[model samples]
Target: MKENVALIGWIATVMTGVVAPALILALIWKTPDTLLRTGEAGQFVSATASVGGFFSSDITTVQSTTGSIAVYNTFSAPRNQLLVVRETLKNGLQLCAENKPDTCVGLAGSWAGDMKPVPHARHRFAGLVTGIGNSGASLWLLIGILVSVGATGILAQHVDREGRRRS
Candidate 1:
């Protein structure tokens, strides 16, 4: 029974020390590689400054205002560009707006975005923007590291406590 408890503790320690961090990294990695690659290559634009043609009809805005935008190669329409933008509005409203004629409406907030070249697709590019106020890859990496370290510390403390109790 004693041996079993120790083994369980060790297993927990190992999992917390290794598995937790590995899982976080895997989750981040599992996201479509193309999306990450595209953001790295795409241009960063500011929506407030550059975006024009301001039109909104009860625009469903949200406090967090997080969203994603991506451009994908259209296999059916090889000659045309497909731009996709997904946003979380402030409220439940269908407000439509676009940039002014010939004007480039920048992305809103501190959005992390990227652009990548599509393979086998002529003159086509793909990109994504995480959305407003997202901390981006660097921040997520930092968070993962911090959480792993914290978990390890907590496990170490638990082991120490158990050791003291046994002795």
Candidate 2:
């Protein structure tokens, strides 16, 4: 019985350390290309102009970096109206805007909003915007794997002690 318990524990430990991490990396690798997208929309404004009014529609993109969401306005041209951008993350929110008059160039809006910083919400796998959620899931999976490996190591030691005591 002790031998069986020890073997089971050892298998679990090895699975966590070896199989788990590999599975995570594999999932990340298998993640589709659309998971990462780049285009003019996501680029920084070359210059600033005046926006007529508050923009109702906003452009957003997911970056390669985990937990980072890029948001921007289609009105790239700067206008007199100040374009307030906000980004909400898991921790908190961030604010940024394109001040008028001067060209609002080089403003890569990711995870930022106009009013309040867009709160970072867990990504949903189902829907049109799966990339962001998929990335988030992948990140969480990796973290879980790491935690599992650590726990496995600690449990392995306990199992070994029990095995020794029984013998």
Candidate 3:
């Protein structure tokens, strides 16, 4: 019985400490930093999460009081929230995604954002945010480490019992 328990412990240690991590690394090795694909229910093709918790770009968010503006949260990460400008330009200003005749205000501006990060925030609204506010890689790594600790504890309990018997 003691031998069997020790063998199980060694097996668990090897599996948790080596094999499992190696498998995870292999699975993620070929994964791309950015992905774009449509959803199953006739959704738009979008760039998937980039490395870390941020997207491949930092989307800017703006708020104005003199007029109404559209709200769009591009990168859904923590630190993804960049410049939040609430300008009150006197001109009947309109910020468009594109430049065309009489479309976007051709005025001097700054703080157009793009480029990804590990994320440190979410959309100001509650419904737009999800997950534990961390990257999947970090979550998985944490899980793996926790499981490994549990396995080690199990092995240690049995080994301690066996040692007491010897003494």
TM-score of each: 0.28, 0.32, 0.34
Query: What ordering of candidates by TM-score runs from best to worst?
Result: 3, 2, 1
The best candidate in terms of lDDT: 2
Superposed model 2: Cα runs more than 4 Å off: 1-134
lDDT by residue for model 3 over 58-155, one digit each (tens)? 33333322222232323222221222222111221223322121223212243233323324322332211322122343455566677777777877
Better of 2 and 3 by lDDT: 2
Alpha-carbon shift of residue 95 in model 1 (angstroms)? 22
What Cα-based lDDT does every candidate model obtain? 0.35, 0.42, 0.38
Model 2 Cα displacement at 150 (Å)? 2.4
Where is model 1 more than 4 Å wrong at Cα? Answer: 1-106, 109-135
Give lDDT tens digits, candidate 1, residues 38-157. 222112231211222446212112111233332211111111122222232111111112221122222333335333433433211111232312224345456655666765576677
Q: In candidate 3, what residue range of length 10 has the lowest lDDT sum? A: 35-44
Task: Please identify model 3 stretches exceeding 4 Å from their true place.
Answer: 13-18, 32-35, 38-134
Superposing every Cα of model 3 onto the true structure, what RMSD results?
A: 15.7
Model 3 alpha-carbon miss at residue 27, Å: 3.4
